[model samples]
Target: MRKKALKAAFPHTLPVMAGYLFLGIGFGILLESKGFSFLWAFFMSVIIYAGSMQYAGIDLLAAGASPLYTAMMTLIIQIRHLFYGLSLIEKYKSAGKKKPLLIHELTDETYSLVCSCEPPKDVDPSLFYLFISMLDHSYWIIGCTLGALLGSLFTFNTAGIDFVMTALFIVIFTNQWLEQKDHRPAVIGVACSAVCLVLFGPDRFIIPAMISIALILTVFRRSLEKEASDHEDP
Candidate 1:
């Protein structure tokens, strides 16, 4: 049954495995270029475990960015998790003392796996889900360590690896576009980000755009739900 559950969970790992390898490798190379070692990359991936934020973390760590800044930005980036947590509280309640840490491990891929799932009667679904999350995370640590070693040993240009993130996002957007019932949030997010970039300049737009988009979605959440409902009814 564990093996069956693992098999069931494997397909869901594809996006994370692919995205994290590319992003992790890019992060590893960048960290190596900044004089950090392969061991450092492995350790960060093990301890930190955030994907996009880890990319930004290089700047934070290197610049000695304030703890207040780290706290604030982490809140902003992960605020959507509040809603995810609220919904999952019941499903995850039995996690005992592990509850808090499990909540912390809830990433884009992990949440997608949980939310998009139906619990099986014969298998312990939560344990299987948790195993998948841990495995995906371990792969990241390995990838980062490998990439750092590769970077140190090789002399190839890694400039193009920057697109690793962009390409991953594009793939995510495309996947959600296909399977997602309500496209408005995704549409709005892209539109808002593009508009903000044009108006606020690339460096200053991301947080502001995310904030504005989040506000609009929050205020009109019912309307978005209604829109999804109307489409379903039709």
Candidate 2:
């Protein structure tokens, strides 16, 4: 039974393991340098496993920050996942009683696999997908723990390591831009955020900007598409 589970998990596990190693190790090193311990890194990787969130977590945890502030900030950082999960609810619900747990494990890698794979009938694919998600998450935790322990003992400068999250976002943005024809929504996000930032200050602007951007995009989606069509015709 375990062997079958492992076999079913391999394809998805392979990509996640490969991508997360460098990322997790980098996060571990940064955490250690920032005065957090190996345990903190390991647990954060297992529980949070959120690359950008872990980066921000360092500062928040360091200051013994307020609950309201932490919740607000975490919401701003991770609200994108709400959109990702929304698109998956119907698809994931086919898993019956196990669906909620699977949804909880729905990281980027898992989502890609579930979306891309055409599972064999009678295979209980939701369970298979869950196995992959769990394995990849374990690999990430192991990598982070190893890196943090090694980092603490070795004592090296880890200044630029903080850029992992920034680089990750830039790559995501670039990929979206390359594939998307009508870039109006992306432009609107940037502009709305910019205006909100100027008005409300950085600490308080993200939620407002996100709400306004979502509303504006939905309201003007057809117009934006028409504008793009007109530009192409011209």
lDDT of 1 by residue, 65-133 (tens): 999998887776666566568678788878676566677678766676676656567767677677667
Q: Which sections of candidate 2 miss by over 4 Å?
A: 1-5, 152-234
TM-score of each: 0.71, 0.65
List clash counts for every candidate, in order.
0, 0
Residue 67 in candidate 1, Cα distance off native in Å? 4.9
The candidate that achieves the highest lDDT relative to the unseen native structure? 1
**Can you tell me which runs of candidate 1 are displaced by over 4 Å?**
63-98, 108-125, 154-168, 180-182, 229-234
Model 1 RMSD in angstroms? 3.9
Show the colliding residue pairs in model 1.
none
Say which candidate scores most in TM-score. Answer: 1
Candidate 2, residue 227: how far the Cα is off, in Å: 20
